[model samples]
Each structure stands twice: as structure tokens, then as C-alpha cells.
Target: MRSSVAVILATFHLLLFSGFCNGGTVGICYGRNADDLPTPDKAVQLIKSQNIKYARIYDSNIQVIKAFANTGIELVIGIPNSDLLPFSQFQSNADTWLRNSVLPYYPATKINFITVGAEVTEAPNNVSAMLVPAMQNVFTALRKAGLHRRIKVSSTHSLGVLSRSFPPSAGAFNSKHAFFLRPMLEFLAENDSPFMVDVYPYYAYADSSSNVSLDYALFESSSEVIDPNTGLLYTNMLDAQIDAINYALMGLNFKTIKIMITETGWPSKGSPNETGATPDNAQTYNTNLIRHIVNDGGTPAKPGVAMDAYVFSLFNENRKPGLDSERNWGVFFPDQTSVYNLDFTGRGVVARPPDANNTTISNGTSWCIAVMGASEADLQHGLDWACGSGNVDCTPIQPKQPCFEPDNLASHASYAFNSYYQQNGASEVACAFGGAGFRTSKNPSYDSCIYATFGANGTTAAAGNATALSSAKPSSSTAASSGSDFGVPTRGVAFFVIASVVALLLYL
Candidate 1:
């Protein structure tokens, strides 16, 4: 009985922690193949300012690794294709590389993954054969340093390795690449590492725009494509592409391994022949992609399975040898200004129309509050920014203070957001929060907890609108649907708590 209880408790804990660890996450690829880009230290600041928690660098540049030390940003570093042969031929080479490139600044740098080679199947001089050997050598070296379990060792592949990805269900690996891919998949499964791949819906649509609808590629599709074999309805091309990879993995009986999108993005500019590459399309794709990932909008094949992806990339590389679109995939320019405004937090819509003076303005009386269904993580991000960097006085929402009764994420976030909004002259940009907040004409004051409003004189109490606000209370639909108080339990925390109790009872 004790053994059975122990097993049950172990499984319960695994399930509990796995859910938290695997929650949908977004990372940016820090590709520095440009002449005028900011230095690594400045780049770190830029990433933090945007609330970006994860970043991937193509190589283990000492300067870049040093810059990330103690910044709390998880990094995915890489090994170039040229080094694969030496790493594969001798374990000592891998050990030396790790000692010089990684070991000295590991835990401080937060290096989560070390990709052995990127897209080896596409590399020249038949490097695909060396991919698995290189990964094994790297893993062995890390194990020698007692770091194998902490930093995952793997390689990234391009979609060119797949023979067919149509309808998603019929996905399969190309026969030629299977020799290396099979062992690689087995290694990933055995070590609990993710199968990294670069997925580009933009390439698919750009290559065959006649067949792929712009709406589908942009995640704006109203219709769905039903897979005849599995009856899975795919609403967007990105999900379908991921599901296709999932199906391919399943075909090889590697169902335990998860997929990580190492790179995915749309370009803001392109050659005339490039059908759908434009600033608007790029913005729409990335914005929707962030929203989808952060919301845990899993593909139909793996519903509710939170996946992590890295957007490519942080800045456009002027020296990249390709079409104009190739050099224009960045969300930001070298100057640190956004190529276009993006909400890295994926909380709210990120559309800002500036006036003639290039400043955001508000037309009428509006209050910025947390959106009804915003995720707890997103709400917390917005709240932290509002109180800290946003320079909002968040005293009223603290313990034993006004507006502290509800004591929930939504309520506190609403208070903080409104405070920031009112202080910032009620500009539309002030309420953006990457889409976590919305401008509501409805006054959200109730009882002693009063929201502030911007006035010609200065900040003023919203009590003047009390009579009008009485009829307009924030809806409790989100809380009721979620079976939590004020929608506070996010990402299935309540469910995990209940499961924990049941497991404890069984153990007792």
C-alpha cells in the first residue's frame, strides 16, 4: 500500500510541476549579424524592457554569454555546422569547447539549451551524418561537468527534412534524412529534450500564395481545414505545420518527445516576387502568434499541450545574404526602436494610431483596466510594469489599503492599470500593456475602492461618475466560467490544488 501511494504521489507531483514548467513561453532569437546593432549589454536591457524572458543566440560568443550573466533571461546557445565534425570525431573537442565557451559562466548565464548544429541536413559537405554524434559528444562533455541534466543538448532542423506536411496527418520525414533523424529523435526522447525545428508559415504562403490564403497564414482565418484522416480541424497554418511535425514524430513512435519552434517569423519587407511580405502582415502574424502561444492555444493534434517558441529575431541583419525579406525579419531596428509596435507580453491588442504630432491621444473619458480574460502571468507582468517602470502609485491595492478587499490578480491589475492610465494623461498607448488592458468608458469604482480619472486640473476621483457606474459593473463571467474567485486561478492552478489534496488523501 505504501509503495502504491508513493507511486501515486510521485506521478501527481510530476504532472503538477510539468504543467507549470511547460506553460506556453515565447523567446526571441538574438541574431547579431549586423554592423550597426547595439552591444550585447545594451541588447540585454532592450530585451528586459520588453519583458522578454527567453533569448537564443546562434553561437556561444563570449561577449554575448557574459552579457546575459545574472540577467535571469534563459538562453539557448548554439554550435555552428563547421564545428560539428570536430565535436563528433573527438569528445575532447566538445569538452574543450564547453570549458571555454560555457562552463565558466553557466548557472549565472542561464544557458538552458546547447544546440549541436543548426539544420545539419541542409549543410554542405555531408554534415548530416555527424549531427547525432556531435550531440552525443556534447552531452557526454556536459555530463562530465555534472551539467547534462540542466542544459539540454540537441540540434535544430528545418522543415526541408519533411517529405510531406500537407493535411498534417500525412506528415513524414524524408527518406534520406531519416538515418540521422531517427537516432536524434531517440536521443531526444531518452533525455527528455525537445525536438527543435524551424517552422516558417511565411515561406509556405509566399511559395504558394495561390493555394494558401493570407488570412490562414496570418492566424486570422474564420474557416477551418479538416484533416480527412483524423478529422482534426486546423484553423491556422502555424498549428497545422506544428501538428504535421507531431504526426511525423508519432509515425516514428517517438510520441514522448515534444517539439520546440527554434525559429519562426514573417518579414516586414521583401522582393516584388514575394507575395505576402509586408509590414502589416508581419505585425499581424507576430502579434497573433504571441497571443496564441501565451494563451496555450495548442494545435488540434495536441490540445492543451503548452508549447514554447522563439520568434526570429531581435534585430534585422543587414549582412544576411538573401532577398530583402531575409534581412527584414526583425521586430526591432538596430536603433532599439520597434520596426513596429509589438506587445511581447501578449496581454492585449497592440494597435496604436498616432495623431499628426506622432503622439497617442484619447478622444473621450476612458479608464484603462485589466481585460476580463487576461492570463494571470500577463496581468502580473502588466501590474509589475505599471507599479515599477510605469511610475504608478500602487499603494491603494496593498494590504490594509483601499481597493485591497478583492485581493485578486484582476482587481489589483485593474487598479494599477487605471492608476497608470490616469497619471499618463489617459493616452491610448498608456493602456496598451501588449493587449492585457482595454479602455473602458465604464467607471470601475465600487464601494471604497475608487478608480482615478484624468482631469484638466489633475487626477480626480471617479466618484463623480458613481451614478453612471452603478449600472456598469465589471462582468463576473470569466470567474464563473473558470470556477475561481475573481478569475484568480490561472493555468489550471485550482485543478492542480484539488489533485494534490486527493493524492495526499490517498497517500495517508
Candidate 2:
């Protein structure tokens, strides 16, 4: 009986450990202003496939929430600005909203954070005034549902909320907005929630390229701007921006509140006049930023602190109104392929197929393929573009050819997309067939299906009959492998508590 009891205790300990929080260095914003984006299921799959663990969505859309259920992806869902007045004016409204929108999908969906309003200080004063009240009501509702401990409540602000940001130590909020911000900061501190803020080095660099070195803004080279007050050395604009915010919080005497980066990213493409918004610059900025945060602690001012950051967006939002740069801040195209290869774990990008002798593929490796969740019609359309407009060889996928026996949209499109992807220097843009294609790390070759891939020698070949294409495992360097919260499996504490009680009763 004692032995059996010992085994039960061991199992209980395993359960508790499984529920412990996992850490992640990177998260992505899931913005859906574009109509051609993949279905929610597909998008979530893509996120998981990419080994992404944390995601922030603008609203608690039912489809999106339902899709994320049981996926272990921690979400920070939002309440739209329009709902602020209603949520704040009446506790019942907030309660009802949570009951209907969130409670139905609570633990299953892993909704860990709630943003009452985004950039409230940037809104009209009247709207900004409702922010805290709405947050309190939401928090109350979560408490009533007995979820306040797990699902945090907070709001996101633009750096525009700060009146001063230079000289990291001199950071201070615009005095005019202090009336609302001070109380908001208090609420965040009381609730143990973070003061979320959007920081964009891209904007800073664009506005004053002469003043900001491109290398410093991109987290490269080294920061020459040292704050005289703190005598701290700075290496990147982002760390400085974060320190500025920290200084601002310290100025207000709210030193205990944590900081969360709600959004930050560079645009891969923009209007002709939007200089430095090229793919190379975007890649450099995001890659280096990810590497810095993953590999190091906090900035000079707040060294050793582990900060939470979410990249601006997953896909370019075509319908969002603003400068061309605003719509182009996505790291991915709508088809769910990287705009550029990124190593979220601070390691360099690894090539596909890897070398025969070594596990890492050479830098020149590339492949083209249809995105997994693309529609049949979209797949056909993309295939057409690749063969006709893209001028990729489609002979292998034609009737009676090696690849034609599959007679499927995905197989044929993969062949054609791979061909186009290989021919066009295997660049990211080569696979974008209006959001129907993506890049692959695994060679998508199968029996009698001769897909094209760019080898290290810069030559293409039909590798004849081979095993069915294996799906690409996420690179070891992806953030998930290093223990992201999304990779953690969560079970309600109630389960463990109940199990312990039951085991005790049985043992006695």
C-alpha cells in the first residue's frame, strides 16, 4: 500500500511540473486586415509549425478563439475601443461580455492576457478616460469567474504617450496625459499586470536617419548615445526606448510595474519615398532584435530583467489605413511564409536539406512550395501564375508525367511553386503567389514527383523517385525548443487539487 501511495505522489508531482509556466523569447502579433489570409485553423497550424508559442489578437473573435482551443498557444485577446464605454459604464456589460466571449473559451483557449483598449492615451480624452474603469470592470468579472490570477488585464500605449524619450535617463510622459496615465499605472501595479507599450525603432530611424545610425537602430554596430545622468552604455535603440519607459515609470514613482512590448517590427516594403523600408533592413532589424532579447537580459538600466516582447505582426495587413509602411510591417506574407528567414532563438538561419555530411544546410539552399492550407482554387491560380507569369517549368506535373499521377492541387502546385521558387534565386518574393505559396525546409519530393530545389552548387535537379515528402520539423533554434510558454501544457489547478484530495482519501 505504501509503494502504491508513493507512485501516486510521483504522478502528482509530474502533473504539477507539467502545469508549470514555460518561457519564450519571441511572440508574434496575428493581424487580420487582409482578406486573403488563411483560415484560422491553418493560421494556428502555421504558428505551431513555425514553433511560435505566444500570439496577440486584436479582438476575441469567436472563430479565432475556437481555433486556438487546446493548441497550448497563449493569447492576449483584446476588447475593441468601441466596447470601452459600455464596459466601463456598467459592470454588467463587462460581466456579460466576459461570460459570452471569454468564459466559454477560458482554460481551453489559454487566454492569459486581456487588453482593455489599445493606445488609449492616443485616443480622444473622453475615450481615454474610460480606460481604467473598463479595466477594473474586466478584472472584477475575471475575479468573479475565478480567473483573475491567470488572465491578466492591461492596456497598450504608443511611445507618443511619452513627452520625452531621449537620453534614456530623461524619459518622461507628456505631462498633459499624466492625469489618466498615473491612475492607469497604479491599477497595473495593483493587479500585477504589465504596462504594455508599442515601441518602434523603425519609426525613429525613418524620422531622423541623420540622427539615428542605421546600425544602432537595427541593434547592430553599437550605440554611441550614452545617457549622462545614468552613465549607462547603450547598444541599440530598442533597449534605450525600453529604458526610457522605465525611467518614465520611475519618474512617476511606480517602479514596481513590469513592462511588456505589445508591438515592434519593421516593414519589408513601402512607398518609394519610404526609404529604408526594404526587405534587407526589415530582416536585419527583426533578426537582430530577436537575437538580442533571446540571448541577453534587459537593457543597461534594467539589467537581468526578462522582458516579454511581441513582434508587430504575422502578415502584411493590406486594408489597414495609414502610411504604406503601416500596412507593410508584417514579417510574413498572407500565405504564411516568412518574408525572410528568421532565427527566433538567436541562432543564424539554417538552410534546407542540410549538407549530406553536416546537419546544417548551406546558406544558398532554397525551395518553393504551396502553403499547407491554401484553397484548391487558390492553389490552381498560384500554379497558373508560376507556370505562365512566373515562367517556371511545369512539364513534370502535366498529364502522364511523373508528378501527374497524384492528380491533386497541392502536389501539382508544390511542383510548380518549387520550380518558380528555385528559378527566382529562391528569394522570399519568388514564392508569393498572392498568398497561396510558401517556402519549405524539407525537400518536397516524393515517389515519381520530381520537385525542384536549389542545391548549394546553385544547380537544380529532379531527384527521381524518393520517399514521400516529410514535413519540416521546426529548426532546433526556433523559440519553442528553448521553452516558450506556448510550448507548456496547462491544466487547471482545480484538477491537481482534486486529484490530491482523492489520492489522500484513497490512501487513508
Candidate 3:
């Protein structure tokens, strides 16, 4: 009887919060694209333990659906792209699939969304054409079963469907796919279902690491890229991607259709070339992502609009094909242990206000270095400022110079900042490059690039021809002579004295 009541309560929570929640709701995608995985019951237990309110699965697996019954976890189920053709061809096929899969345990299981096709636009067989028809048939089947209003139907799309996404405000769907996408948008609008998108900054960063900063991709950057046209300042890539999709939809005159992030996660491991696929990076990305969404601050283009997102997967699928990153998006290993610690509730890593002052540097030997986790753009910004305003000699970081062998922004910035800091008596003001600079106790001297350290006499010699600017604060005194008059003496005459004499003469 106690077990029965627990199940009933779980069911109640699922029913109430499946569509919307009081706090920021994050879901997990339980993809079983591998040979080894636990049974549905054990997976459900893990989900419950994490206190996750939402979950999405690749298929309408009967066992998984039944396992979720009375657990109160709302689910977004998917229909594979291969099955889309059959569903699109005939309503009977859709009804059969729905009856065999979803109808048996929907409300009890808390199924709220049925994604007909996953990223169909990127499918090789031109499955994009069948997405709308399949969605329609699925909707019709749900209506027949008297569940259309409760369960929304839509297909997940990749950002590749959009021809332009850079400026966010200028995002537009590719003209080639617009024929099919337009009708699909209409169907979604008519049904009030969201336009689901699978957004991944990892892919964008991987393709163009030189131009895109890692901090921007991971939602950890203090710097922002503003869309000039819309005056929208985008601090992270995910929000920019979402706003791009929204702008695309609004371009088509479908302003009311909402957007949902059906899939988004970072891989914990990958090939040698996949530089950003480390476990630490994965944790940082996922954790920060949850906090950003839960804070209820939507994208700049669509302020205050709440978002619903599902992390890519539950467990890594070893059998999955493609690059190493392809199989490692899971938050947990196959054993159900989390790959990295995460607070799904978004309270674990509370954001602190920006430090008003920079890291303290005692009057001892120290090397000014780049702050860890600072973005490439941020490093560049600081480097430029150090070389320009800070007046630090950066010749060592130039090509053919000793420090140039390392040839990276961070390394160069460190060398330059250290030179400036040491020259300026290592003052606290000189070391703070808008918080991008950090004072390192350990020497960062590497192979050919040796950083400078302070001497006992409080002044250090130059590390090879590097010169430093004076640390003196410029006086605010006005220029000795105004440039307006050519060789005129303004100090000898007083305007007030001349005015007084003219007034006295006039009175007499």
C-alpha cells in the first residue's frame, strides 16, 4: 500500500509539471544507441534519484513507458526517421504505431511530447520532406485516441536548416528546405506545438575554433558578441542559436510558435582533434547551461521567455558510430554513475557577483598570466589592451622572437603582462587587465619563452630587449598654453580685470 501511494504521488507530479514547471525544468535524453545498457526500471530509478522533472527517449519503448508510470517524470518520446515514411504514408500506420506504443501508458507514464523525427533536415535520404506529413498523421492519430490536446507533436531540427544564423536577427531558413519547412511551421502553429531544435555549440566551435571562443560555447564567458542590427548582446552560443531559430520563425510571420531545445550536450571524450571534449569541459558546459536556463533570463532577442531543454543523453553508448565524441555525450556511464558531478536543481553552483577588485599580488616575485577558463576573445582583448594602453613591449611574442615559438594568445598575453607588471613595480593596478589578468606565484617560463620575476632590489632587468613604459599616472593639469591662439600670451591678461575696467569707465 505504501508503494502504491508513492507511485500515485509520482504520477501526480508528472501530470502537473510535464508541460510547465515552477522552477527551471531540465530534462535528459535517454538514448540507447549502444549494446550495453541497464533495463528500463533501473534507468527510471536513476532518473528519480537525480530529481529530474523531464526526460526524453529516442523511441516509444513500451518497457520504458511502463517503467515511468506513476513516477511523475514527464517524457518527450521520439519516432525514428526510418519509421517516419510509414507514418507519413498512412494514418493507419500512425494509428497502429501510436496504439501499439503510446496509447497503452501515456497519461499514466506522463508522456507530454511526441517528436516525430530527430533532425530530419540533416538526414541523408531527404527525410526532411516526410517530417511534416508524419507529424500530421501522428497528430491525427493522437486526436482519434483523444489525447491530442495533452501530447504535442513536432520534429527536432538541426541549426543546419537555417541558411544564416550568425547575427541571430538575420537568421533565415535555407531556401532549398523552405518549401517543406514552411508547411511544417504552419502545422506547428495550428497545433500550438513548439518548434523543436537540437542545438550544439560544440559542433560550431569544433568547426571553427580559431574564430569561436571556448568560453562563449560553454556559457562561461564574461565577454559578449552583440548582434548589431538588433542590439542584442549574446554572452553564450546556446542563447544566440535559440534566438537565431526564433528570428527565422518570425521572418516567416510565425511569431507565436514557441521553441524547445530537444537535444543539447557536450561530449566528455573524443578524438585527438576534438579539443573541447574533456570531462571537465563537459561538466562546465552542462552545469552552466542549467543555471542559465533556470535563472529564467531568456535570450536578448526574446527576453523573459522561459526555455525547456533536455541534455543529450543519460549514458554513453559505446557501440555508437562516428568520431569518439559521438559516443560520449552521456551524463552517466553505462553503470549509471554520473560521468561528472552535477546539481540538476541548479543550486549547486550559485553565481557570485563579479569581483570588484583583482586577485591580490603581494610585494613578492610574481608573473602576470591569463586567468584560467578565460575565452580566446577575452585573452585577445586583454593582450591588445596590454600591448596598447598598458604600453608593454610585445616584441618577444612576435614571429621569430624567443617567446613566439609558443605562438598562442594566452602565452603571449602572460609574457607581455608580466613584463608590464614587473616594470611598473608589480603594482596591483598594473596587474588588473579588467580582471583578465592573474598574478601567478609559480614561474610560467617554458622552453624558449622565459617570464620575468621581480628582483630583491625591487627592480628587475629586461628579459632580452623588452622595454616597459613609465608607471606614473599622467597629471590632469591643463596644457601650458592653449593651442587656439597662434603664439599668443594668454597668461598675461585677465578677462575678469578687463571686464571690470570697461564697467567702471562706462559708469563714470
Candidate 4:
């Protein structure tokens, strides 16, 4: 009996370890704005195939919620901005919406959260005023249904909530929105819901290239920007964005509220003069950024806590308004082809074989992530050798963690040409080796890539600025290892791309 109990207990422990929040999480916001998009059922298949555990859709599309049944993907549904008045004015409306729209989907679908509004503070006029009341009413209705504990209430915001973000330590929320932001912060803090921010480093860089270096914004260069007030230095834009949020909460004395990035991405395509929109820069930005998150160093403001990020979008939103970049934030194209590359634990599934290696580009680089089968032992091995810790065998086999591409490196010209060749029946040579993935052909315009970033030590990032001199590109012989490795070669000519980027940095 004792032995049997031990076995049962061990099994239970294993289950809990797997079920409990053990570590890093990868997710996406499935925004279906285009008319020609696939059905929700097909969408579910795509998300699940990519191993994405969390998804945030703009609305509570019943079809989407129903399709996710038994799939075990966590969801954060939303209440459209238009529903605010009715939801806030009548508790009954909130209850009915829950009963009709949510209750039918219940535990079967794993509806973990409901965003009451999106960027209310950033919204014009009284929209900001109505958000909190609606959120509260929604909370009450969920409680009456006894679903409050199971489902958290929250909202997403834009970085415009912060009045000043330059010196991260000195971050502060705009005073105009404080009336609503304060109580909302308290409610979230008490309820254990995270504060979400729709942060786009690309926008900051695109709007002000004179002030924002492409490498610093894309996690490539190590130019430090100091906040005159806080006396803190920020090496990258993402880190600065997070620090701005942290400082804002601290400024409000809501320092304990969890900060979650709801949206952040680099556009794969954009208008000319959008200085850093090239594929090489896009890959480098995302590749290095992913590497930053997979490891221990949280934002400099929140050390020890693993950062939680949902790469802005799963697909390019062709229908979205605004400039060209607005519609190009997807990691993949509408047909489910990856736009750039991403090297990390998180990778999206491709419906067909790409012609070459790819990356999770946000619009500035062309990096490659490791193949999905990468393990921590492999990562540690790479880190050991790369950092001169002397643990890696430095063998010619696959690397443990995903490596990055140099800032201006062009693994492929543009996808249009590759697609042309693929359509013409030349798929083999079309697959080139590089960051995040091996795809047919990539657009010359987009170079941003996403790859793994591991800390040399448990506490600090592996010397920020992946394109720095310390990060040398491997040789060409190694670069052409095999077109089949969807991930890039961490040991060849690709490695020196970082060195070249660093050489460029010296001149910068």
C-alpha cells in the first residue's frame, strides 16, 4: 500500500509540475481583420500546430471559442469598444452577455480572461471614462455566475499611457488618465490580473530614427540611453518599454501589478524612409529579442521575474488601417507562411515547406531561430562555448539555442522573387539557410528576425547588442550546412553577422 501511494503521489507531482505555471509561455493575438482569412476551425489548427498555448482575440467570436474546445489553449476574449455604454449602464446586460456569449462555452473552452476594453486611455473623448465602470460591471456579472475566479477581468493599453518613457526608471503615466488608471491599477493588483500594454518599439524607432538607433530598438546594438532623472541606462527599446510601465506603476504606488505586453511587433513591409524596415534588421531585432525573453533577466526594473510576451500578431492583417506598417506586423503571411524568422522555444507551424531558413522579424532584421526540438542542455552548451565557459563541444551538429543574423545580412533577396521561382517549380534551391527559418525567398525589404537569447549568467543578458563584435558570424562553409534545417546555423558564417553589426556600431 505504501509503495502504491508513493507511485500515486509521484504521478500527482508530475501532473502538477506540468500543469502549474512552471516557466516561459509563448502566445499570439489572433486578429482576423481580413475578409479572405481562413475559418476559425482552420485557425485553431494553425495556432495549435505552432504549440501556442495562449491566444487573445479582439472579440468573443463564438465560433473561435467553440473551435478551441478540448484543445487546452488559454483564451482572453474581449468586449468591443462599442459595448461599453450598455455593459456599464445595465448589470443585466453584462449578465446576459455572459450567460449567452460566455456560459455556453464554459470550462470546455478554457476561457481564462475577458478584456473589458482596449486602450481606453488612448481612445478619444469619454471612452476612457467608461472603461473602468464597464470592467467593474463585467466583474460583478461573472461573480454572480460564480465564474469570476475562473475568469479574470482586465484590459489592454497603448504605451501612450506613459507621459515620459525615455529614462525607464523615470516612467510615469499621463496625468490626464490617472483618474481612471489609479483605481483600475488597484483593482488589478488586488485581483492578480496583469496590466497589459500594446508596445511597439518599431513605431518609436520609425517615428524617430534620429533618436532611436535601429540596433538598440531591435535588440542588436548596445548603445545605452540614460534617463536623466532616474540615472538608469537602457540598452534596448523593449527593455525601455517595460521599464516605462514598471516606473509608471511605481509612480502610482501600484508597483506590484504584473506587466504583460499584449502587443509588440515589427512590420515586415513599410513605406520607404522607414529607415529600419529591411528584412535583415527585422530578423536581427526579433531574433535577439526572443533570446532576451527565454532567459532569466526580466526588464531591468523587475529582476528575477521571467518576462511574459505575446508576439504582436500571428498573421499580417491586410485589412488593418493606417500606414503600411499597420498591416504588416505578422510573423507569418496570410497563407500561414512565416514573414521572417524566429529562433526560440516558440515557433509557428508552416502549411508547406519554406524555401529557406526564416526568422520572427518585426520589420528590421533577418535572423534565424533554432529548430523546435531545441533543449536547455543544448542551450546551456551553446552559452558555455559562446561565452568561453568551456562546456560546449563546439561540434558541427545543431546548436542548443537559436542564433541571430547580423543587422544588414541578406540571406535572401525578397520573397516575391522566391515565390515566383517556387511557382515556377524551383523549390529546392529556393530554401536558403538563415535566421528563424529556411524558407523559399524573403522580401529584400524585411530583414528583422527572431532567435533565441540566453543569459551567460542566470542574472544578466549575454552582453546586450547581439550584433556586437563579441558575436562573430561563423564561416560560409558552415552557413550552407543544409537547406533542410528550418533553423539557422549557429556555428558558421551566420555567427559573424553579429561581428559585422558590431563593426558598424563602432562607426555609429
lDDT of each: 0.81, 0.76, 0.76, 0.62
lDDT accuracy of residue 239 in candidate 3:
85
Candidate numbers sorted by lDDT from highest down: 1, 3, 2, 4
TM-score of each: 0.73, 0.66, 0.66, 0.67
Per-residue lDDT of candidate 2, residues 1-508 (tens digit): 6777777678777655544433226888998998889899998898887677889999999999999999999999999888999998999999998999998987899998999999976776568888889999999999999999999999999999998998989999999887788888999998899999999998898899998888888866533677899778786799899999999999989998889998998898888878888776787687667756665556778754667889888888899888898788887788777676554544433222122422322464556666545677898998888889887778877798777744557667777887887776677777777777666555445333546666566665543423322223222123222332233313446365557758785766
Candidate 3 Cα misplacement greater than 4 A, ranges: 1-23, 350-508
Which ten contiguous residues of candidate 2 have the minimum total lDDT? 468-477
Considering lDDT, which of the candidate structures 2 and 4 is the better prediction for this target? 2
TM for candidate 2 is: 0.66
Cα error, residue 278 of model 1, in Å, equals: 1.9
* Residue 497 local lDDT, model 4: 46
User: Quick one: best TM-score, which candidate?
Assistant: 1
Candidate 1 residues lying further than 4 Å off, grouped into runs, are 1-22, 352-508
How does residue 372 of candidate 3 score in lDDT?
A: 52
Clash total of candidate 4: 84
Query: Each candidate: how many clashes?
Result: 6, 3, 0, 84
The ten-residue window of minimal lDDT in model 1 covers: 474-483
